[model samples]
Target: MLTTSTRLKLQNICSRLAQGEFVSLQERVYLQKFAERDRSVSTWVSRAQRFQREGTQQGLDGLMADLDLGRRNPDDPEHPEDDLGDWFSNASPWLRRD
Candidate 1:
């Protein structure tokens, strides 16, 4: 099993790698090791290849778009205007202490 730190290291590398950012040899090796333990890491790497092929954004943004989650703005007109920042930002019936 990979340690949490190793996984975190791999996740960071994965994001950079996906974004077409430069990564060092050591980081590549670490990623390879991480892939050995995690199928998802390899999956993300392959997904990056598609982004390159399509000449798309090729990063987290592209990934989100591909995943159909591109619209992240809470203020978007499609969403309600209630602008509740967080569950703790205000109290709703669900959060009623009484």
Candidate 2:
């Protein structure tokens, strides 16, 4: 349901979070813009913002833990394959998706 540009932004945000780096302007914009419509993405954005303000990597670490736990998506039909979550699960926990 996300546009190409938005998808790119999401990918970039996930990458930074995965790397334990701070989120960027474009990533913030993506989160804010999509928060209303996407609960998963919003949750991630909320955690990111909270951890940032608290001055800790707890949120990022938590995200890594979630990734390691793996996840299941009932929304996307093309799953267990090229879906973003599947890609992350198959590859790197640092890489994230929503």
Candidate No. with top lDDT: 1
Model 1 pairs whose backbones collide: none
| Per-residue alpha-carbon lDDT of candidate 1 for residues 1-98, written as tens digits (9 for 90 to 100) | 66788667777787787677899999888778767767777665556544544547668977775774533344567765454455445777787554
Q: Show pairs that collide, candidate 2.
A: none
lDDT of 1: 0.65
Q: Which segments of candidate 2 are over 4 A away from where they belong? A: 43-98
> lDDT value for candidate 2?
0.60
**Backbone collisions counted per model:** 0, 0
- Model 2 Cα lDDT, one tens digit per residue, 1-98: 87888767775685566456887777667667787788766666545444443334357656754453332332447654345655577875566554
Q: How much is 74 displaced in model 1, in angstroms?
A: 37
TM-score of 2: 0.36
